[model samples]
Target: MKRLISTLMIFAFALALFGECALVFEKYTTDTRIKPITREMIAAQIRIEEKLSEQTTVNTGEPHKSTPSRQDNGAWMLTLVNDKNPLPDAYKPILKSLSNGLQFDRRAIEQLNSMLSDARAQGLSPVVCSA
Candidate 1:
């Protein structure tokens, strides 16, 4: 009976402590005016901005020069390679190995490096699993 009473006393103490903590938390949250922005929310915003940028052309001061489309430069980069669209047996790309031993297409290595560096500059750790 004594052990039962002690356990009950401990549980009651813990319950009271928890109630105090909850009250403190409620007061702190209610007093705050700022809302938290999550990484997922920021990523969603980045995706929306990317879509909008793709549809609009930037105003560079120089006259517009017609450059060949990406397809004309490197059609292989645009190839759809998934379960539904498998690559042909004869298809072979000129690959280059990165410093960390990951391989990507030689044609896009410069652009990929630039993108990775840019992302790093903006405080994002990007991991490229595949090209």
Candidate 2:
């Protein structure tokens, strides 16, 4: 009986501590006029915060992407299976389109286009492909 009573006492203290923590958190987020609060309300808010944190971490891919599974630069990199006989110059417009919305020269595009054309003439997939 004494052991059971002691366990109950500890449980009650733990509940009190949890309630205090909720009150403290609410005090920080709300005005002092919060005269009353329910334990359920505090528990709900804690659950919401935990869910949001989990979602943010999962969506950002920080911990997972940091793993060196494949060779890559910091920025998302793509590999082309085929630049479709895109003359080396062919890629220039795309590259330029990328740079300042294509304000750059078109010769680069022509070179890429020619290179792609030559590669395709060899019966290879010189096409624009992405990883």
Candidate 3:
């Protein structure tokens, strides 16, 4: 009984501090919605971050690892994330960056999804990493 009371007190205290609103994310779909990035996705994203700057590739902090092959065709699909915004950000900056800095191939998006799934199976939830 004492342990139960203590646990209850801890829960109440946490609620008092963070409040119920902090749990708001639990109510929504993570994909195409409000949520944090996953670990596997984080891993994949880290790989992508490396590919962004050619000048810094030699100095990049991460190791060079094999990534999923990008789509050979010119077509690609992507979701540009804006941490500050709820809805998906527009295609201006993202498109321009891709056009100038990287290949707009379909493989990037597919690889991210694949990594995210692997992470989920490895006991990681699909919560956003930077969240």
Candidate 4:
């Protein structure tokens, strides 16, 4: 009888240990779903963040140079135009007509003409292929 009681006590202890482990495992398990990420998604997210950062203003004690509201008086030179910084809808650059019947930004016309003249003088036969 004594030996039988000892055997039953050991079985009960083993069962309790196994039950506790099962409870612990279940408690730690997660049911949340994880989605896979792609390179294009990361690139697009980065581009969006960069554009948002460009539009946001930083608070500095000193006065900061503000972006020009209009692209006038050669202000376009200092303006940044890229994937992150886009041209304003109201911006209309000054246009000038070239001798070759081409229109370009007035600010750049002088430099473009100078370069063409120099190339011609050097006998390079420079041609305006595309604007």
- Going through the candidates in order, what is the number of backbone clashes in each? 0, 31, 5, 0
Candidates 3 and 4 compared: the better one by lDDT is 4
Relative to the true structure, candidate 4 reaches a TM of 0.41
Candidate 2, position 96, lDDT: 50
TM-score of each: 0.39, 0.24, 0.19, 0.41
User: Please, what are the lDDT tens digits per residue for candidate 3 over residues 1-131?
Assistant: 99999999999998876765555554453445655779999999888887776646575588655444544365434432344323323534232113224433344645655776899999997643331
- For model 4, the superposed segments whose C-alpha errors exceed 4 Å read 1-75
The worst-scoring run of ten residues by lDDT in candidate 2 lies at 79-88
lDDT of 4: 0.81
Global CA lDDT of candidate 2, please?
0.62
How well does candidate 2 match the true structure, expressed as C-alpha RMSD? Answer: 21.3
- Candidate number of the best lDDT: 1
Q: Which ten residues in a row have the lowest lDDT in candidate 3?
A: 91-100
Q: Which candidate achieves the best TM-score against the true structure?
A: 4
lDDT scores for all predictions? 0.84, 0.62, 0.57, 0.81
lDDT of 4 by residue, 12-59 (tens): 999999999999887667535644689989999999999999789676
Better of 2 and 4 by lDDT: 4
How much is the lDDT of residue 47 in candidate 2? Answer: 100
